[model samples]
Target: MNQDEDAAPVEMLASLCEARGWQYEFVGDDELTTEIQGSWATYQLRAVWRSEDHVLQLICLPDIRVPDDKKAQMYEVLALVNEQLWLGHFDVWSNGMVLLYRHAMMLGDDGLLSVAQAQSAIETAVEECDRFYPAFQFILWGDKSPADALASALVDAAGEA
Candidate 1:
């Protein structure tokens, strides 16, 4: 099968689960279920609606399970990079939830942090990625590193605060 075909399962599953109030959980490629969490902070994805009072395990990509809710403004950010970054498929476990790191960073593109919390959140996310997403690296602001143009944008955003 081609890349598209391999990637289809995760995308379709995510879309279906999202439509039915089901959340995605990232587990390794196996039968047993495991809980995945961020390496940096106490961040975990949460299901808006519990599936039978139990979290569902989904086997797909690491970044596939980012929370769909919270920070209404972040949707624009996520949508902007969907093509470049989120094109791959991931496995999600059903019993896992995402934790929103209160003190995470937000690396922006303007070489200035557009938001103060961006840095902490970014750090948290990076750590989370490191822990659960070793194969997949975390890129902020289009750059391939922890500190880059996106970090600056995050600073700029925080300056407004």
Candidate 2:
């Protein structure tokens, strides 16, 4: 793990999930899936360990769904929500029906994932998804403007301290 080499970071994530008592199951040799219950909603999180690139991607799909009639507003909300985050940005899936938050951690030359690295990626996904669930909801169902939705959610972009 000292440099670019075969890495089993997905195993590391499994260990983390087990240690935290969060139920998760392996998808394959390189990926895993789990649900993280957040304050706003429970989210499905998938972690894919990209061996060649030495990266682990955590994609979090919240319970929010964008109806066809609300796609315009949802697009606006996507802009507002993504601009307010440091770790990840929100995006709609190819189906154009589901919204997801995506964040990635580069394992660097070592291709190793530390506990903090794994924890950060997982926490970032859940936290961002939870934080903006209401904003998406406001846009999708409440007939609220993106600005109003973000304002109501008290969301502002994070800057480094």
Candidate 3:
């Protein structure tokens, strides 16, 4: 796929969300950027989005020169998240490997449980993982396991928030 081309699954998801009255927007571009966390450091935070109750995000880097198999694994991890979780009421935020899970726990503009909250929950999740583990490694070598690990991490982080 072209660095600028979004995966087909994401496009389909976006269409589905739109059909359901949710707005799907993609953010960011194919610009080279530094990986603030992880070995094999340096990547691009390619895209982001807002769904009805979730924040959608994508990042792709054709550089940093990792093995192709590893990159495919990382892509799988992202695909799994979008398929199983992101299409729901759970609000999400992401910048590539760093996915922030929040919402449903905050006070609304009217002081009730708001649909949006401080981004700390998601931020802390990514920070904690980045501090203790290697994001690039996960993406490079993380097969199906990475998906599970990420899902657990997000759930734990949201609970903390």
Candidate 4:
């Protein structure tokens, strides 16, 4: 196939998800939603194929609700985590409760996103979301500083091994 040829269609992405044993539903012609089970919580992942813009977007929403008082701390921790991430970044809703991790692929320049690329994007979102979830919990419930929460979250990973 020509390198500039359009990548696989949305249907192919759905098939890939199914083959991987993921439960998903099509939200629209260009969007698919799947639920991923994480160590701490179940995450809702949504993939959108923007054919016009030639981008594939992946977003993961963890089962977390940041309290009003913790919004600032949550943003601080998110900033720290975002800095460490190679792809995707954490974002908070204006309501200060909803948190989501988002990543995008420019299909126009990169060509169609292969199955591996799609899977990698999904995995990366879930992995990063799982890693930083506890930090948000700490900030919202434990009242820990952003730095402290992040440190504790990272240290906790070491203990998991």
Report the number of the highest-TM-score candidate.
4
lDDT of 4: 0.81
Model 1 Cα lDDT, one tens digit per residue, 38-118: 443322432121223322222222343334442222333333323223222222234453212122112223222212232
Clash count for each candidate, listed in order shown: 62, 0, 2, 1
Q: Output the worst ten-in-a-row residue range by lDDT, candidate 4.
A: 1-10
| Error of model 3, residue 42, in angstroms | 11
Candidate 4 deviant stretches above 4 angstroms = 1-9, 109-111
Stretches > 4 Å off in candidate 3: 1-67, 84-137, 141-144
Predicted candidate 3 versus true structure: per-residue lDDT over 14-71, tens digit per residue: 4333444544354333111122232333323233333333443433232333454555
Please report, in order, the local distance difference test score of every candidate based on alpha carbons: 0.31, 0.81, 0.36, 0.81
Which regions of candidate 1 deviate over 4 angstroms? 1-31, 36-38, 41-71, 86-161
Alpha-carbon RMSD of each model:
17.3, 4.4, 14.3, 3.2
lDDT tens digits, residue span 40-73, model 4: 8999988888887888888899967777777788
**Model 1, poorest ten-residue lDDT window?**
98-107
Q: How well is each residue in 33-144 modelled by candidate 2, as lDDT tens digits?
A: 9888887888998999887998888889996778888888889889977888888789988685888998877778777787777777888888778778878888877888
TM-score of 4: 0.89
On the 0 to 100 scale, the lDDT of residue 85 in model 3 is 40
lDDT of 1: 0.31
Order of quality (TM-score): 4, 2, 3, 1
